[model samples]
Target: MSFAKWIGGALGWSFGGPIGAIIGLAIGSLIDGTAQQGGFLLGDGQTSRKQSRGTHNKRPNYGKQTQRSQTQSGDFEVSLLILASVVIKADGIQDQKELDFVRQQFVSMYGKERANHAFRLFKNISQQQIPTRKVCMQIKQMMDHSSRLQLVHFLFGIAKSDGIVVEVEVKQIYTICGYLGISSRDYESIKAMFYNSSDNAYKILEITKSASVDEIKKAYRKMAKKYHPDKVIHLGKEHQQGAEEKFRQVQKAYEQLQKERGF
Candidate 1:
């Protein structure tokens, strides 16, 4: 079943607190009066749940996950909606550039059909008040390290949509990472991709500005190897595409440095 259908079942309950009601309103607003017109997109999700349950029951014993993680993984789309909402609001207002960046990413991954539902979910999510740290804590507990890392990566991309990551945005990502039990350095590395300044190319390549040309080239090569989308191919096509975004940044930084230093 599509992730969209899986999300409707948990929309009102998963978030909890004031935001839970807010999220319910969000979904309700998008889905209102349209059920008769387009019910499939806003399915009650009973079929999706039954299908998922059946699939879980059939999983080999050795590969089975506890019900807890399964529940968490099932909420992946909802979590992204919430987390992306928080990031868009981090700078005190919703910026079109950020929203468009996120929208384009969703469209790229889910295609026009599903991306419409996703964009609606995201659009609605943008209108609510998010409890950033609490939700981050929940995400930390439910999601694995790799998934969290990718979430932060997407957040950074939104933060940088305006050409530079402002202080508040950076602070927000750092705070979320802290709550997520992720290392600050990992956030820093992702941050480098979006915000470039005087010597940012060097930073992106993880090399010193004063380093020898040979050393810079070596650093670029190493970064390319490390960030290649292939490194994350196991995560799924969407993630592989997102990784490609980071990989492109690495390539661009290297090329810019190469031009400046005549490498």
Candidate 2:
């Protein structure tokens, strides 16, 4: 008989005669065997006890699932474009400097073809409704705090492309950084570094206030070559703009040091 019927009859036979007891015993044994085959057992079944108490043999798909989670959504597409627009407009001029930077950054991180497509996609998204936090949350979920902070730095780099970051761009970047959950101090630190990085670059290149004329020229050339936009052209147009701007500032720093030192 089936397990359900057996259970019902067995319970009903609590006060039945010996014949009822025998039938119940046989049915209970049959039900117990079936339960064991299906990963269960009666109270005293050794196989059930062992299986229940033993470690699971199944290997989890954690890595696969984690990778899947990382690429689960396409939510960053719009936000990245929005931020790109913000950075490009930061200097009040959407010149080659800003465009080149955006291109190179995307290309390095996402590949040239992908970067080109992304820029085009960004343009399209710019025309549409800017998505709300609900959409951005999906992208944020995929990124850890460090990655978010890095993204903010990239934004800052773009913002500083044209030598001067416009107030609108600064406010937009601050808002974007806030949405990304980056602390204000961290964002300010990143921005401050950008603002003062020409000096830092000069210091690193050993172009001091007392540097000679030839020394300043040599330093400027070295700095220009190091940050040359041509090297990152493979990153595409958007990225080249930023790198070009950086190279320009490198040249500017060298000139400033020269002027101060009467080079």
Top TM-score: which candidate number?
Answer: 1
Range of the 10 consecutive residues with the lowest summed lDDT in candidate 2: 66-75
Best by lDDT: 1
Residue-by-residue lDDT tens digits, candidate 2, 98-170: 8777777767755676466456545543333343343334335444443354456678778777677778888
List the candidate 2 regions with Cα displacement exceeding 4 Å. Answer: 1-79, 89-93, 129-138, 197-263
Report lDDT (CA) for all predictions.
0.66, 0.49
Tens digit per residue, CA lDDT, model 1, 1-263: 44344444423224443334555678786554345444333223564355354343232222233233443322455677788888778778888888888778877875676667777777777777777876776666655665676788888888888676788888888888998888765676677776657877777777777989889878878878777776654434655777777788878888898899896
